[model samples]
Target: MVLISLVTGASSGLGRVLAELLCEKGHRVYVIARRKNLLEELKKQCKNLEGEVIIIPGDLSDGNFRKKLISQILKKEKKIDYLFNNAGFGRAILFEKQNKKEIENMFKVNVIAYEHLAALVLSSMKKSNNGRIINIGSVVAFTPLPYFTAYNSTKSAVYGFNRSLIYELKGLKVTSTVVLPARMKTGFAEKAYDCYKEKGRNMCIEKFNKIAESPYVVAKNIIKNMNKGKEIITPTLRAKMWYSTRYFGFVVDFVMKYILGPKERKHLEQAVLKEDYKNS
Candidate 1:
């Protein structure tokens, strides 16, 4: 039986890279994103790939859009072998700085959309007898980030939700895995920078540049671990180490405060604000 894969946020970044890789691996790939032009370009690019590529363009933040997307997918493909809940966005700002609309929109896209889509796909996946759900989480979810409060909270929620779902699905044919990675070099950073600039602040470009990994690397690791049916997959070595030490709260606090220090924090905030301001 041919495996079918559904990937959201597939117009760019990790999602796009992963979709291409999966197409190359001979899996029928259904790519979801808001940009029709970008998705078309991706379809063109995947023409030579082994598997078929289908473009599904719609804003994930809209419930009707998500429902329509699932309905259309079911009409075409009877079952999806893998459901990749990779569509999410984040911002680098203090909690108070973000307004109600922004907060709700983020939650809608990052959390609600995933939950709705997962529920839509679960029954089919369960019936398929072998399927996987890969959720893209973040390392920031492992610890508290003062400035990136909402983003951190959403990721933390994702971690908790995926874990609970895993427990509930125990002994079932469907398996769930959460991919946690540190900063990755993608359009996400640029978007965050743009948002900060609009607020007359700049992002910490240098700090992110130092730690970010390519989206390709993140996608590669995800595919590698997914085949093995791993429960929690942390891509980068630094992220793995950081998550491992998160059990020791005192140590994490001391290290982040003293070792990394206030100086670093100030510098990051300033740099981020400056970049944001310039972009704005």
Candidate 2:
């Protein structure tokens, strides 16, 4: 049976790699992104894929578009077999420096859109009696770092959602899998750095540059584990190691603060002082 899968943010980065891989595996893929031209290019690149590719050009942040996309999918397919909630971006700036509009946009795509889409698809999934949801999160969800405060929080919300969904869908053929991946060479960081550079922030780490895996490698592991009934997939050895850090609890926090504290403290202190002056 050819499975039907919906992949968001499929025009680039990890989502693009995952969508292409799904096509090659003979799964009918519905890909959504803001870039129509890139989606067209992906279609051409996947010409030899055994399954059909359907491209939808829209923004996940838009409620109307989300409804229309879900409606179109249900109208055409009996049920969506897989839903990959992979549309999200990173903000690399101090928390006080982060834009309110951008923060709302992140939550709209990362949390609200993900949850809404899952609800929309759940009815059909329950009817069909089988489905899988793979939400692409990050290791930062567990190991929070400075500069990515909002991004990390959003992913942590996803982590919590994925965990609770496992119980909610119990006894059904449906399952939820959350993927927490370490740094990967998918240009996600480069985009994040675009924000970092503008703020004159130093968010770079040599370790991430040295050990980051490729998106294809990360996607392959996620699909393989999701197939094997794994509810939480952590791609790459480093990601698994980072996940293990949760066991150490505050030790992880201490280490993060040690690494990031010096550079970020002054900015946070200044912000606090400014707020205090306004109240006075």
Candidate 3:
């Protein structure tokens, strides 16, 4: 029997890679994103693959879109075997500088959309007693960065939701696995930086780009762990290190402040001075 997988944010990055991987493995995949062209391109690329791709182009932050997405899937697929809750983005900006709409959008996409979509699919999954919710969280869920406060909060919510789900799913074949990945060499960073750039102002992403890993490799590890029935996964060595030491507040904070590389260090200083001046 073939599996049915739903991957959100499938226009690019980890989500796109995961959708492609699922199709290659003979699983019928439903890819969702705002960019219709990219989703269409992905479907074309997977046309001759072992499985199939169904593209649903819309914004996950929209509640109606999420419902329509699940409704369309349920009409044909019967039950979804895998829910790759991977639709999210991060912007690096000072908390005080972040607009209200920006914060709401972040929560809507990263936290609300994931939870709402999971809830929408859970009924069918639980009734069948066979399904998996693969939550695409980040290491920052545990290790919150200074400038990415709102984004970190959203990821932390993802971790919390998935962990609670595991217990709620006890004695059932249905499971929720949260995978925290390190920095990925994807459009995520570029988009994040671009979103926050205000003429002369800049967000330093040099170090982040430097330490990034291939999303393809990360997606492979996530699939491997999912198959092995793992609940919590930190795929990369760097991700593991960052997550493992999350509890060491003082050390992590120190490292986050002073040892995040000179560029980031300098950026942080400038941000602080600028904020202080504005407030004063």
| Poorest 10 consecutive residues by lDDT, candidate 2 | 194-203
lDDT per prediction?
Answer: 0.81, 0.82, 0.85
Task: Please give each candidate's TM-score.
Answer: 0.89, 0.88, 0.90
Model 3: C-alpha RMSD to truth?
Answer: 3.1
lDDT of 3 by residue, 76-151 (tens): 8898999999989887666776778989999999999999999999999999988888999999887777678899
Give the winner by TM-score: 2 or 3: 3
State residue 137's C-alpha deviation in candidate 1, in Å.
0.4
The C-alpha local distance difference test score for the whole of candidate 1 amounts to 0.81
Candidate 1 TM-score over all chains jointly? 0.89
Backbone clash count, each prediction separately: 13, 0, 0
| Model 2 pairs in collision | none
**Model 2 C-alpha lDDT per residue in residues 3-80, reported as the tens digit of each score:** 999999999988999999998888899999999999999888788878778999999999999999998999988789
Q: Which 10-residue span in candidate 3 carries the lowest summed lDDT?
A: 271-280
Q: Can you write out model 1's per-residue Cα lDDT over 1-280, one digit (the tens) per residue? A: 7789999999999999999999989999999989889989989999998987899888999999988888788777888889899988886664555677988998998888888889888988888667899989888787655456788888988888899899878888788888888888777766553322424433455445567888898898898888666779998787798788788989877866776545444554554344433432
Candidate 1 regions with alpha-carbon error over 4 angstroms: 194-203, 257-280
